[model samples]
Target: MRFLAHTECFFGKSRYDDLHSALGNTITGTGIALIDTAVVDSAAVRDLLSQVEIHFGNAIPVSAVSVLSEPTYDQLDDLAALVRQSDPSFILAIGGGSLLDLAKGVAVLLENPGLARDYRGMGLVKKELRTMICVPTTAGTGSEATWTASFIDDQTRIKLGINGPNVFPKYALLEPALLVGSPRKVALSAGLDSLVHAVEAVSSPLATPPATALAVKAVALITKHLPVALNSEEEDSWSGVQMGAYLAGLAMLNSPGGIASGVSYPVGTQFHVPHGFAGGIILPYVIDFNTTRGYRGYELLNPEMGSNRTFYQQIEELYGILNVPRNLSEWGATGEPAIRTLRELTLNQRSGSFNYNPIPFDEADLNSLLHLICQAD
Candidate 1:
């Protein structure tokens, strides 16, 4: 019954502009904006950021703006250094998950007085971080709603997550219009990622009733709307995808993810596959794997594709329609040796999700799943 996500969430086409008056004219100090370089460079996003600045007026000045590119753990340290010099009163994170995660790291470092590595796990930060507002330019990752921030440890090639209540953003603005310009590939990948989040959260053993409800609703929305949103110009489809992703994020924040995401992390990071694509590619296999152990979440999903088809079958078909990568080798995780390495890395970097899996799994189960996931189709 334990559920937590304290951020105030706003959803609409242009609701982001409301932040101007939401802060109540407190413009005495510096406001830092951590923006994705590619996103900020776009004409639309550039105009959006400018509007946000205009909304703030002079009460709080966005005195510093940093463009985040390919964020890594080292980047957090560098961002921290910059923040120390600027002394910003608040942080605005605008971009994908990496930028938002980096913003969390920067805010935590500003107040906690330590390196980003110090608070690598849950509940490590004793002090509250500076206020942060997250505006996600992409629909996946759910970084806007979650208390977890992930960073890569380049030395070990492991992506570590910083989890704590202090990491939660004070505000999350979900603007569907911002996602309209996403490349088709990005849209397909991110939409599937959101679907997987809903599935994993609903099926996790730790799921609370409220979280499960959100997960079910998210899954339904994603299943019905994602495919249409991928190639259509209709605003309703895109808006549905946006709201579904946010709900899926909230569900994961309360219940956490399970084996699918756990396996996807190492595979995606090690093989340079986009996280959403990696997760989507492995989703059907994980669903089949869980079915062996009496997992029933799929049964709870609406049986809309067809009465004869299983939920996994419907998703597998969707993967084909979306043209998701079919083989691990396509992403450079080829050969038995590479898969073995991925399996070991997955096991080594468990991310506390193994326990949340409804079925008991160990090295052998993981090995079998990896073989299936990597098999050429």
Candidate 2:
């Protein structure tokens, strides 16, 4: 329930200090803003900092800044060292999923090392973090807003995560302006991730009313805004995208997402596709698969689901709004060779995402689902 952003979110300007004040942390942080991004090296954070300096004077006092340069392996090593060394006040991450997730992993591992894998299934971290704040940039992943961190286990090559309320940031900074300038492609891929968040939340086995409500709001927002943002030469309407992304995060915080978002980590790690795109491609197929196979959680929202949309139309509309391919082949994946591996990975996933899928799937069921995604038109 506690997002790193101020629980009472502020719309304009840098509410960073206010968030800090509310959280009562003023100094050291493992901050990773887009400016610190290794993928593209964004200057947006620098510009935002400059403006802050202009308005509030010179000293930009932060605890520490951790740039996101490494993939999974090195990042965890670096994070572990930080906790072992300084014992800093907290970790504040400001980047995309990887960056935010890095912060979460660091915060949790520092405190709980004995039963690390025990925390793997869900709700296991059971401890408080060293303090943390998540400032999301791409408006997807919702890492800043969620309470769990997704990570890969290198040796097993199976996807896994460390979860608990402790992994959730002390605040989730929802700065719509911070998200405004990202390129359309990055925005869209991430937006699609959010759409998946909403859809899966609706049918997710983890369904709770609060989580379901958030997903619906997210779907409505994205359905209305993503296309406009995607096509405009200058997307002055970025706030809609930003809000949509936040709602998706909120939805997942509740329902956690089903198999598509669940299955994506394996695909991302094994196939080398980025997580957003990996998750995006599997979503529609999951919805299609679920339509005939399991209980649609949206039944709780029947009046709005209209028998057609929530059952069928709602899902069809999501794919259209995101403009994604209906199959994995469209995303360049081919054949049935990967199905077994996918099933292996799906079994590894166990709870967080796969458990919430509309239907309970065994190895054969998973293989079938992947085939549908691979072959669907």
Candidate 3:
């Protein structure tokens, strides 16, 4: 079994303060802070920025920028250029997956000699990236723990991840307080994204024993806590979901994702669907397809469900509780033409995921899956 070391994680109610204190003492040079626009105006973020200014003082000159969701390659190049002028010692990413991804891309570009597009595939980064500390406000993509940063290629309109060991964040700060006031839809989508990650990781053919263990525990935690985190204001619930998401991300570091992840990229890039929502929506169908073909790996994900209902059914029930749609029709991807387009795009852009999937899903299988995903609920 292969094992990969990941980010050093700090978890708690006020871990951000701890991070600030640690960095303030250690970092004597300039740094760049990327904040998600969604939470830029929040009191928590405001206070966090205030603390950054106070703690760092003159020792570290920090520049803050607001980033939007679903960053593109152009945005990465532009942000890298802006940060290059500062010659930052580190990057502090505060936000959800997209902002965190943007921060990772910027970090890669700062130290690498070429443009962001030059390193779109795996193991292309010859230089170590500047230190990146990811502070995720949401419990979704687990970008803080993962070693890949996804972005859209504006020239081709394709979503590709800049993947390698260099993309891993040096530190991850999981503070549940930051997730307290997120919109229900945003929180649910993010939680479901983590759920899909855990499920897919466990089901991947490349999954090691350690990776499966983490993914299984992540699945259990997400299934139990995501609903509570969404419905209640309890920090513990959010913490549970957040830890689950982080574990899922770590698991996925060793195991590649399956058809659901492959489908998400095309659907998200073409239809403007949120990545997490698109993956979550199609996950159940993918599970069903696998199980019908004699893949029983998912039974381990939620062993507590027993034999009364299949694991996929339980996931569907969770979606019902969360009020997430079952397909991409809501994003205007319903017709046959949409399915064909998504199939071609998924084949071209994300074939690696399919190659690693436990079940060998060919073009016909992909077409079928896309039909299921684009079908009306």
- Count the clashes in each prediction: 2, 11, 0
How does each model score on TM-score? 0.91, 0.78, 0.93
User: What C-alpha root-mean-square deviation, in Å, does candidate 1 show against the real structure?
Assistant: 2.5
lDDT of each: 0.78, 0.64, 0.83
Window of ten residues with lowest summed lDDT in model 3: 58-67
Q: Please provide, for model 3 over 240-359, each residue's C-alpha lDDT reduced to its tens digit, 9 standing for 90 to 100.
A: 999999998888888888888878888888999988899988888888888889988887865754446789788878778888897887889997999888878887878778876787
Residue 213 lDDT, candidate 3, scale 0-100:
93
Ranking by TM-score: 3, 1, 2
Give the per-residue lDDT digits (tens) of candidate 2, residues 222-324.
7677777676634445677777788788777777667778777767776666667778887766766666676555555445444544545665765676576
Candidate whose TM-score is highest: 3
The better candidate by TM-score, 2 or 3, is 3
Q: What is the TM-score (0 to 1) of candidate 1?
A: 0.91
Worst window of 10 by summed lDDT in candidate 1: 61-70
Which ranges of candidate 2 are over 4 A from the true structure? 1-35, 38-43, 50-74, 82-90, 109-127, 233-236, 293-311, 314-322, 330-332, 351-355, 359-364
